[model samples]
Target: MDNYLLLKIAHSLPGLLLLLGLLAHIFMLWKANRGGDAAVLQRKLRRTRLISLPLLGVLALSLPVSGWVLVNLVGWPLGQTWLLASSVLFLAVLVLGLLLAGRLAAWQALAGSPAPASLLRFTAAYAGLIVVLLLAIMGLMGAKPA
Candidate 1:
């Protein structure tokens, strides 16, 4: 209806998409863990991971960019130390996400063919980090610029 609404919408849309994609990736990892043939599960995992790359990138960037814009344009003053800290943490999480994503992509591509136990362990650990990051991001978002 107005500029503030537009800004809030723009920022939240990307953030929500990113959150949704993260949830999807998380579920896929869980699926991989459940009953299934190792090789087939690996193939499916790789396919899902491969497709998630661009989506992750889009979410990773869009969330912060739009969020910052909205906060700057429509949100409260950044004087709140908690909000500022959360913003920094959110950025750190995004960077880690981007870096880990590249590593995960490379690993998925290589390990997709064989599906080693070690690789699955790696996926599990990496997936764990993703979950942590998502939780932190969600917390920071809920904190907002209060």
Candidate 2:
């Protein structure tokens, strides 16, 4: 296989992993939220964080490096409109993701108590932002301009 193929796979795999991880994390959170036992909810939240955080970090780091390699291999200029837009969206996603993580930490800190309604609303909003940004980035990548 060529370098482009290898790099493309490297770039794409992380995206799939990130999407699945996010979905799973959200599902776990939903389940925990629905359960009445505070101790059970806390344990599930901690477990989800422990598994998701490292995966998120790895996906976040892998994306740019692999994307840069793929861009170089294709000889696409960095200033191209699609690439520029994707980069901006990527950064936005990162910032939003960090904010969501902070919110999760705050949720975790609520240990024995139920998560506040405001915090749940914020988490859902942040998660929606991340999903929208990610989809925009995917669109840009798929519709690479001439």
Candidate 3:
């Protein structure tokens, strides 16, 4: 009913959605790769590159804006240690996400050719790092002082 609650919901919802979307994308890509159908793999990669990735990017970008508003609403200073740590982690996630996108684009560019094992491993590792960073950020947010 209040501004804090409203802002909290706004900040939290997209974060949850983004995490879920990323996990889903990872599973989808893994499944497609395991299916051993080049056409399906390419289609999955293209769809993720063009549609899912962009939508997730928008959600990812919205988080800091909403989080800033929520923090201001709560009258918390921006320079708190947890906030700073989370910010660093968030930036790491963003950079890694972009790198992942580039790797996915390379996969898509293969146009149904079999993806290299090294490329697949690198992409998966990047995704794993992003997920870990995101989780760390969430933990920092949760552990912040009331």
Residue lDDT tens for model 1, 1-146? 99878877777676677767777876765676565556655676676656776776766777667766766775567767656776676766666676657656655566435546775576666656666766776776777544
For model 3, how does the per-residue alpha-carbon lDDT over 59-128 read when each residue is reduced to its tens digit? 9999999999888888899999999999989999999999999999988888888889999999999999
The 10-residue segment with the lowest total lDDT in model 3: 130-139
- Look at candidate 2 and give me any clashing residue pairs: none
lDDT of 1: 0.66
Best by lDDT: 3
lDDT of each: 0.66, 0.85, 0.91
Q: Give the range where candidate 1 is weakest over 10 consecutive residues by summed lDDT.
A: 106-115
Q: Write the per-residue lDDT of candidate 2 for residues 29-142, one digit (tens) a residue.
A: 888788778887788778767877777878977898999988888998899999998899889888888899889889999878877899999998998888788878888888
Would you list the rank order by TM-score, best first? 3, 2, 1
Model 2 root-mean-square deviation: 1.3
Question: Which has the better TM-score: candidate 2, or candidate 3?
Answer: 3
Query: Model 2, residue 71: what's the lDDT?
Result: 89
Clashes of each: 0, 0, 0
* Candidate 3 Cα errors over 4 Å, as ranges: none
